[model samples]
Target: MNPIIELRHISKTYYLGKLDVPVLHDVSLSIMPGEFVAIMGHSGSGKSTLLNILGLLDKPSGGEYLLAGKEVSRLSDDELAGLRNKFMGFVFQQFNLLPRMTARENVILPLVYADNKTNAPDELTLLERVGLKERVNHKPNELSGGQQQRVAIARALINNPLLILADEPTGNLDTKSTAEIIGILKELNNAGITIVMVTHEPDLTEAADRTITVKDGVIVSDVSSGKQRTLAAAGSDGSMAAGFLTHNLLKLQRVRDYFQQAMRSLISNKTRSFLSILGVLIGVTSLIAMMALGQGAQEEVKKNISSLGSNLLFIHPAAGHQGGVALEAGAVTQISLQDVDAIRERVPGVARVTPYASGRGQVVYNGKNWNTRIDGTSADFPVIRDARVTEGRFFTDAEATSRAKVAVIGKTVQRELFGDRDPVGEFIKIKRIDFQVIGVLPAKGSSGWRDEDDKIIIPVNTAMYRLLGKENVDTVDVQVTDYNAMDDVSDRINKLFAVM
Candidate 1:
């Protein structure tokens, strides 16, 4: 039979700043399968470190640890955790049960991490085994020291692990509770579970099959039972396979048992859980509220820019930098209607194309006159510029092609010339050319550069022939389908212009 735990010259060192503090030094130990072993030592004798290494909770600095014939250091963190959950269980002197969980809930908590996909062990049944059936629903604080330790024992056995590591199992108990704990451990050993306990008391070691005394990180004495009690195992090939099948089936019983335990704890301590959840809710709510406000502000800015035709790549002449300074974009015009049509046909991300021209003009309506900028644009102007008609409707493509003397007046123009009177369907004189005001545009306040609202829009043909008397288009504003590829498409458009 292979040894359950085999350690050869295991050593551990922890660093406190620059100083190297050694715990275990050249410590060699072996414990057979199914034997109760007690590791005894004084305080600061590195007993806890040895227990940690044995339990796979701490790694040895220099040594080989073979757990059931497989080296431990080779396993990854998750794999080690799985193996610990599957094969080994722990019991502490503090009886570390969650204060909110009942006795049965605490006992069955390990099955959650055990990955018992189905058919987990019955929590109530395990509590019964530890003589806590009557106190199964009791919480940790409600139980006495001995009953709490019993609950701990039930928990250790819940996973059906091959070995148990009890760190000072009865240290905190009174005399009667300590005796009770020791007896329960003895009963478990008699029933064939291997238990390794850490203690300094002689009375505790009396129950163990073997006792190993350590002083200053080195073993001073080792007394064994000399093959007295061997592990109760299914040695026969058929029986061992059957035993494993049974364990696996039992593992299937408690599926996600840990989550259920957590839910029960939360339900049990409703007030604390509610407070915690409420704090998180308020934090997330405030975050969302602030984010919504920020998003609204961003949209307002985008709306303003869209009013000036956002998502637009102006295909006008690129002004040469004068005195190491680049002039305002689209300030000078060399592009034409032919360039706008070419881009709409060839460019991939282009959504729409608008060939536009702009010039200064004076307009009069109702005997009131105002000086404003005149813009002649295509039918897609309102869509691309995100400008909504406040009254009447924008000029249609047919009307623009027919060179109709129709115009869309802005808020500032309406305020100056119409002055609270309806401007739509009124006749306005631009450059002494009488044009009918077909619609009124929503307000766009002035920026530091210019007054955006003091402008009028008309058909390109009408502006060229009847108003400004220009034949060629100055700017071609192209809208795109995707903003991510905006720069690439603009560069491509530039390359096409270079070829032209």
Candidate 2:
């Protein structure tokens, strides 16, 4: 029969930039079944690297390694993890226990990552087998160093792995604890399980079946267990049965158990767990606030754009030229109400027409004086401008044509002049003109550096003839029903105005 582990001409080299650092060179070794081997070496003898390679935790740069008649050097990362979890168990000198979990819970973690079968031996039973039955419910923090190592040993044997790799298992223990650990290893080896240990103490090797000393990455001497290998071969004709609890399939029933373990870990490590959860809460809150701000900004932009109406154009007086000097727009030429009426009646896509003229003025209410905007527009101002009167009513066509001096104040003007008092049916001064406050425009908020709700609206004829003493209007705000027809209507309006 072949040995359980075989290493042939193993070599390892590490690359540091452009230089190569060689560690091991041309080493061949073999380990048989049921053998308790102890590897000893000085500090920098590459024993740890050899142990890592032998345990399949790492691969050699150049070598062939066979485990149970199968070469596993070139396996993928996941395949190596599966093989390591299935056939091999690891024990370290530090006794890496999850500080939050009880001893029994820690012992069952290997099975969680392996073929966790429902019929496998109980976790408490494994702890009992390691002489930790009384300490099954106690955590690592509550146990002594020897007790912790015992827990680690119980965990190692949970999967019933074929090989046990113990790296300096007695490194951190007292003399009594170290002796107890060695006794456990000897007891395990006698029960048909194979063990390979790495230790620096020579006295610990007395219990091992064989002692191998390594020097400078090469095996200098090896002492066997004194068992002869020359014997008659026994013939077996029948094929062996395939294993059911293998590394292939996993159980879904253990998922809840694993989750419970996670919760227990969090509960045990209170400070670290709180910090982690707080980080998640802050991250989620920041994301939600940022999303709300982005959505609000987007809605604000769309609202401002929609308030101006869709595809509408403001028809202003064309600029005038005099003595080769270009005057500002509306300085020499003016648009009359006739053009506004014609565009409203003749333009195909024109939805509403409102003549506009405005100037700054001071308004006084209840002895409180404030400077504000005064807009002079027709009654169609609400339709063309998307303005809403939340308090009172807009001026009528009959009231606008008669230049009744009715006014609609913005929300900002309402707050500044009225001070929470109802201003509807009240009169305010515009350039010392007594204009009655008829309605209040809906709050439009701010847009970039401009306040949309700080103005007043009045009749176009009132502003053109009565307030400013101007005979013509400044601009005509036109609303359109169809966006696609805007270009055609704009061209026709320009041509008609040129002739008029």
| Cα lDDT computed for each candidate against the true fold | 0.82, 0.83
Residue-level lDDT tens digits of model 1 in 236-268:
222332233234423433554645666877887
Between which residue pairs do clashes occur in model 1?
Answer: 118-252, 118-253, 119-252, 119-253, 119-254, 120-252, 120-253, 120-254
C-alpha TM-scores of all predictions: 0.64, 0.62
| C-alpha RMSD of each candidate structure in angstroms | 7.1, 7.6
Top TM-score hit: 1
What does the lDDT read for residue 2 in candidate 2? 64
Error of 1 at 29 (Å): 1.6
lDDT of 1 at 35: 90
Against the correct fold, how does model 2 do in TM-score? Answer: 0.62
